[model samples]
Target: MTEHTESYYAASANEYAPFPALTESIHCDVCVVGGGFTGLSSALHLAEQGYDVVVLESARVGFGASGRNGGQLVNSYSRDIDVIESSYGADAAKMLGSMMFEGGEIIRERISRYRIDCDYREGGLFVALNHRQMSTLEEQKANWERYGNSQLTLLDEEAIGREVASERYVGALLDRSGGHIHPLNLAIGEAQAIKLNGGRIFEQSPVVKIEHGSPAIVKTAHGQVTARYVLIAGNAYLGDKLEPKLAKRSMPCGTQIVATAPLPADVAKKLIPANYCVEDCNYLLDYYRLTADNRLLYGGGVVYGARDPDDVERLIVPKMLKTFPQLEGVKVDYRWTGNFLLTMSRMPQFGRLENNIYYMQGYSGHGVTCTHLAGRLIAEALRGDAERFDAFARLPHYPFPGGRNLRIPFTAMGAAYYSLRDRLGV
Candidate 1:
């Protein structure tokens, strides 16, 4: 059995009954593979509608990126609405814009209806380091406003300084709707809700292969699941292993995060007066928030290839200190790395495999809210309402410029170009 990684989330995770592994062949109306946000959300939605559902997880709940991400409830895709409009057409963008904020709404709905204790906080900040970045943020705010996001307020230098206690940012965009949470707890809580709705979840059941057909069969190491409909929610970790076709189209990349030991409440408040999660506007941005226990959780830097670094603190601590030099000499209580699936388009990839099998993945780095949105969309499609879901599916997703053998270096070069532009402030 694969145990959960030793991260702050795992150490401080809520206690729950362990789910059993699949030991006997089982049949159900829907077989959801993966126990993360997408699968859990899909199962919960379907279960609420009285569908027979069975969830198979390779490891414990929230064992992958769903658990290890910097817990920010960001409210957009990796490639924002403007990019969607420019790349696709205005019509396509309009169709997607309607659902842009629905993911965060679904998250809030789940939290309220089920009472998931994930330290739900409200508000997020997009801090700009220079005039160039601030200009881009202004444009971003306008674009978001065009799509009906009226919760945004631009903060000038003095206003942001008062809120963040930092001089690095010239300004910031405060999104009242965007917020942060204890991500792992959200996942586990949703999984528990799934069970309450009459869904069965099997942990430690890695899917070895999936037979695509009208009634597909998902085979695990110890058992098999036969279902009329199959929802493939395994994004970064299971794509290459179980579905090679999807593998050629996406790459997994690693991001590191570090959690400082609990700071004095006064110190924490001084660092972030409003307790809003903050991220820079750089191509390779740094994001930080205060944990429920007052620990400063900071994350940044990405490895093109999804390989855990030997030292997580070495990669993220410097970035944290640069933003908050007041945190110098603070001891880091936990450090870890997690992989998120990235597509060449940097947009999410959603589509159907064969006839009854559906697969959704590739959130780039914005999975917190998007995954929950995907779950609702996938459930809708399965229930014969594919309009909203099909809009995302209609977008095309291609493999990286180079194939799998060279995708890492190719993506790294593209990121480097953007990083240079950010450094030059042009």
Candidate 2:
């Protein structure tokens, strides 16, 4: 069986026995083509509602970005609802706005209902490095409040220090609903929940092709699954081979993270007194949080092309130190990189391939909360409640300009431009 990537998450994950690989053709009501958050969530939801579900995973569960991410439960899409309103319309924005906070609610619900011991903690902070970012946070506070989020509290520099213990931020925005978790453990817990609900999961069964029809046939090396519906949830790892059309509009980008050895209790408290997760407000932001074991887990920086960096430490250490210079001599216990699917629009891609083949991918960088939301929407649609799902399908997804060849350089150029603006505090 394939193993999870070497990261702090994998090292500290719960002991889960590997699910067996598919060995023969089988039939089900639905076939999920990935085992990360989206696949497991869709399968679990379908299984809960009495649908026979089969999940085929290319590697171990949570082995992809879902496992290696910074584990922040950030709300809203990469492009927030206000942007959707201006770009789409008021109606489209309202439909999306109603669901902006639902993903975090669903996460908390799963944790409580299933007794998932993923070390979930409530609260998240968006810190601002300059006056411009502080103004943005103020705007965000108003926007989020308009969307019915009353849990938000704007923190001035003094208040920010009470939460962040940092002198670098001008201010911060705290979202009580947002939180962090041990993501790999959450995936494993959800996988077990799927089994408890009678859903079949097959790891090490990478899909080879899909024969779309009334009943789609999903083929793997040793087995095949015939099902009424299919979902392509592989995101960045799906590659250009499995779905060439998807490869055109979306590109994979790598993000790196590093974890320090467990810090002393006093040091941990001084770093993040309230134990809330934090991410700076920037075009390309830096995010960090204290782990359950008192380790300071930090991540930032994006590699436009999906290639892993030669050294994850070299990419992330400087950023971590910038946030907490006191940790100059701290030992980094782990370092790893993972890919998040990026689209030209910086929004998720959701649409239909054929009559029965549906897909939900390209979450950009907001997969943590949005993936769970996608799973619920997919379930609702399959159960004949598609009004909610159609809201997302209505958005137009454009391919990156210059196609695959020039997309990376093009995106990198844009990122450089934004990075410069961030530096200038414009």
Candidate 3:
């Protein structure tokens, strides 16, 4: 019964054919659970490699965070490479740094190879609200440079204003390699590409149980899939009925987004002349970009336990107006919320269960590109190349301190502390 939210992305999504639900037992080389970016990307790669792949979704493809996200194809992990270097060591950081941009590259390569049009734009800006954030961006630029990212430029206050037309930023960093897109369309296009490659996708097929063996059996309400390998990429929206162990290591966090009514083309150009997607540097950040049809898609705010509010637009519109006071009376054309998995360390979780089954989740708020990277690494491991996959698997993950019940308030307190620091520009 899961369905796509009534958001701008859903309304404007490219033609996506409805996939039939699983009604009979079937067999495949790999059965992937969750049909968002991770599962779809993994299935596409596996299908291209000639594996008999089948994807199962609790709802339509891209019905979760993948479709509802802010659509920025940003590079790197959630915690950043410097944090990785400090925690893991120079060697681990170097290895991770090497793969930072590959995820974005994978996205571009797919769009070109498959000729999928998702209104792919080619610029992104990380803005600073104060000197502390600017310093952080300087360090980030230097850190990314060491990792072979040369498409970066630091912008001063004046340059930042010129790039964004907003006076809210003190400085900014532009990454030429970073970009934005219609995320839902990208997922739908990839699903279509997978179908064209002969992979099967069943929508509205919630996995009720998983019976594991040398070959695992994935059961839906009316059908089942027996596969040599089972890859679970169901991140935040994944329920715990199937696997409680995977659910504990990460917590689901909800985020809200609002889209303004289409403005005049000239007014849109005046608002963000460069048309680059921008995100501010803060614990709870605001991200926005101009859509293809001239609407401003703005997103921010978070609920730690993934408890969605009834009035998403009311919660997010004020933040948007705070950033752009000129749009104080702008009509909100669409509003929605989505959940993403968050880990204590702000890093993704990649590991295997029962040898033949694998799972990857915990991208935090940086799923757009990292999911693609995870998909690639998972596929490599399935093909007998486990070196890269093991690298991510080595990163440690911990359960929430207060367990399931109290983790929400505990994490909210921690987030509030950082948010206070951000507000004070500490």
Candidate 4:
């Protein structure tokens, strides 16, 4: 059985009963694959709407990026609003802007309605590394404001230091609507809610083949799900061969994170005075936040080929200490890595296969909140309301250049150029 990685979130996640693997064939109104945020959220929404839902996961729930991410609920898509407007025109941008914050809202509503204890916090900060980046943030603040985000504040150098005891950042953008959470607990809680709503979930049931028809048959190792509809929510960790076409549109990249031993209350409070999650405005950015237990959870470091590094701590600690020099000898409690799907355009790809098979993937690294929005949209589409979902689907997506053999090297080259621009403050 595939298990969740040994990380801080896994160690601290809420306890839940193990879902039995699929051992018999079943039929339902909806057959959802992938047990992470998108699949679970889709199941929860469909179950609430009186649909017979069955979820199949290759591993345990939250075994993928949903559980191992930085835990920040950063709003907005991977490609900024400006890119959306420029690429797809103003009409598409206006539509997307309206729904940018809905994902985070869905998360908040679920936590409250289900009483899920995921250590929910209420703020996030985008720190600027230099004057050029601050200028970009000023524009970002304006763009978000035009989109009905009223909880934004741009902090100057003095305010930036006050918000995060870091001298590396010259300024910061604070978004009250963005926050952090114990992501794995959120997933597990939603899974429990799915069961309560009469939906069935089967873990360790990796899909072998999906036979598309009037009622699709999703064959797993031990069983099959015959359903009228199928929603493919698997992102990076989707190792199955059900969709070679969709897999070609995205490449998985690895990111690592480390958690320090719980710090003294006073020291923790001093590090981030307001307890806001923080991420820099760099091409290769660093994000960190204080856990509910006062430990510093820091994450950054990219592996282009989706290859896990040998020493996660060695790769991450120096980055953390660079942002905060006082932590010279802090013991790293836990470290792990996970992969997220990336698209060439850096925008999410949402579309349908045949008539009833739907798929959502390629949120890049900005999926924590986007996945929640996707679940709602998918549910809406299933209920004959595909207007909003279609808007996202209509956006153009291209396969990575040079195909799978050379896509990694090609992407790394593009990233290197941007990283240089970030370092040069261009």
Q: What is the C-alpha RMSD of each candidate to the true structure, in Å?
A: 0.8, 0.8, 0.8, 0.8
- Residues 1-426, candidate 1, lDDT per residue (tens digit)? 798898999999999999999999999999999999989988998999989999999999999999999999998899999999999999999988887888899999999999999999999999999999999899999988988899999999999999898889999999999999999999999999999999999999999999988799999989999999999988888857678888999999999999999999999999998999999999999999999999999999889879889998988998998999989999999999999999999899999887799998999999999999898888888889999899999999887886999999999999999999988988
- Where does candidate 2 stray beyond 4 Å? none
Judged by lDDT against the true structure, how good is candidate 1?
0.92
Question: lDDT for every model?
Answer: 0.92, 0.92, 0.93, 0.93
Give a tens-digit lDDT track for model 3, residues 1-426. 778999999999998669999999999999999999999999999999999999999999999999999999999999899899999998888888899999999999999999888999999999999999999999999999988999999999999888876788999999999999999999999999999999999999999988999789999999999999999988998976679999888899999999999999988998889889999999999999999999999999899889889899888888888888888888999999999999989999999888999999999999999999988998899999988888899988898988988889999999999999999999
Model 3 TM-score, all chains together? 0.99
lDDT of 4: 0.93
**lDDT for position 318 in model 4:** 94
Q: What range of 10 consecutive residues in model 4 has the weakest lDDT sum?
A: 237-246
Tens-place lDDT digits, model 2, residues 371-413: 9999999999999998988898878889888989999999999
Task: Give the TM-scores of the predictions, in the order they appear.
Answer: 0.99, 0.99, 0.99, 0.99
